[model samples]
Target: MASIQFKNVVKKYIQGKQSLQVIHGVNAEIADGEFIVIVGPSGCGKSTLLRMVAGLEEISGGEISIGSRVVNKLEPAERDIAMVFQNYALYPHMSVFDNMAYGLKIAKVPKDEIKARVDKAAGILELGQLLDRKPRQLSGGQRQRVAMGRAIVRQPQVFLFDEPLSNLDAKLRAQTRLEIQKLHRELGITSLFVTHDQVEAMTLAQRMIVMNAGNMEQFGTPEEVYSRPATTFVASFIGSPPMNLLKNAPGGKPGQLLGIRPEHLDIGTEGWSLVVDTVELLGAERLVHARVGDELVIIRTHEDQGAPAIGSTIRAKPREDRQHWYDASTGKRVGP
Candidate 1:
């Protein structure tokens, strides 16, 4: 296992003669065996940062160190990191055993050691019986496991995953997530996973780096990022339905925006007047979309609490304890 340190890392692209710097000088520290996720929307620098760590992309400035060794100048193989890609890049004709063994074979590792590593990886990934089967014969999740097994046999200092579950279906994605968690617990390898999905980041990360438009937005545990967003972008991006930012609303100061999560809005008979626009029943709970003045807001209420009718006027207010304040001018969090 290895700890990764990023010191003011930057990336730039030369579009003709003009240089466009996408990743700013982003700094972060990831402890040994920590599963860190770099998360943001599309076009954000999350993948670029991960690629830099993997030595797949050139670092325009600053330094990246893995295990106290600066690896900015190292080759991908010399970095001692194994990356699992989004596409599950497996050889179509190769059996699962051969696929997992291919890397070790190329490295000229002893046949017995390769076999030992492959067998151990197969058992850990629950692909023991499927080792003889070719990639073409395996299911999507099975193929994904094969890809992971291939990486596992390497026994690298760090593990890098680039949206590895994006191709899986919803059910498979959830199941694969559990498998990944179990794998991490068993192997205890330092991992860096990149994803645009906020839910994945919140669930999987021990600590996550949130990015926005090439800027580092916030870096914290899920709870800290969710409850105490350092910036307005984090407050609005980390949640499911997302936190609401009410501009010029009641209880908000001038030049500041009021931030409250949908689940934090209490529905009652007396408070801000909201015209219910729609109600979405989601099994045990419901989401109430309502118009409060000109801005629309969503409130999550349990089914037992009852759903309000559409087009009905209701009263809802942001919970004082859950309120977050952001600077209107800079979109950064203002007060606790």
Candidate 2:
């Protein structure tokens, strides 16, 4: 295992005489055996950053190091890293054994060692029964496991995963997520995973780097980023159903935005009377969609609790300490 460190890294693509910067100056340290996830919306440069670390993309500036070795100019193969891509890039013609052995063959490892490694990885990934199967014969989740097993068998210094679960069905994705977590726990390899899914970032990462528009928005543990967002974008993006962001509220500065999670809000007797625009009754929870002063807000509550009728006025009460204050102009968090 190896620690990965980025020092003021940047990437820019030049197309048609236009230099579009994809990654701004980013500096972060990912410890050895740590599962660090890079998360953001599409085109936010999370994948670019991961590719840079994997030696797949050229860095425009700054330094990158795997362990103590600077790898900015090293070939992808020379970086001692194994990467699992979004699409399972398995060999359809080769059996799973041959596919796993191919890397060892290229590296010229002893045949016996290669067999032992492949067998161990296959057992860990539960792909032992499908070793003879081709990529086309395996299910989506199985193919994904094969991809992971390929990475594991290599015993590289770092493991890189690029949205490895995006191709699977929702149920399969969740299952595979747990499997990946288990794999990480068992192997304890240094990993850098890139995904646009915040839930995956929150669940898989010991620490995560949240990026936006090529800039590092926040870098911390999942709890810190979720409970104490550094910016309005993070507060709004990280939560399910999103945090209700309201502007022009009393006790806040002019144009300042106040953000509160849906669960933090409650229906109370005395507060802002919002018009119920829509009501969605989920089995366990009810999403009371309402309009408050031209802003659409969603309140999440238990299904057992009665909600205000549609078109009826419901008082929207805010949570005191849970409220997030953001600067009106910059959109960055203003206070604790």
- Highest lDDT: which candidate? 1
lDDT values for all models: 0.94, 0.91
Per-residue C-alpha lDDT of model 1 across residues 1-336, encoded as one tens digit per residue: 899999999999988999999999999999999999999999999999999999999999999999989999999999999999999989988899999999999999999999999999999999999999999999999999999999999999999999999999999999999999999999999999999998899889999999999999999999999999998899889998999988967666999998989999999976799999999999999999998889989999999999898899999978888888888999998865
Residue-level lDDT of model 2, residues 239-334, one tens digit each, is 888888888664656768988899988898876778999888888999999888788889999977886789999887888889988987898998
Return the lDDT, model 2, position 209.
94
Question: What is the TM-score of candidate 1?
Answer: 0.98
Model 1: ten consecutive residues of lowest lDDT: 243-252
TM-score of 2: 0.97
lDDT at 107, model 1: 99
- Pairs of colliding residues, candidate 1: none
Candidate 1, residue 199: the lDDT equals 82
Per-model clash counts, in order, read 0, 0
Models 1 onward score TM values of 0.98, 0.97
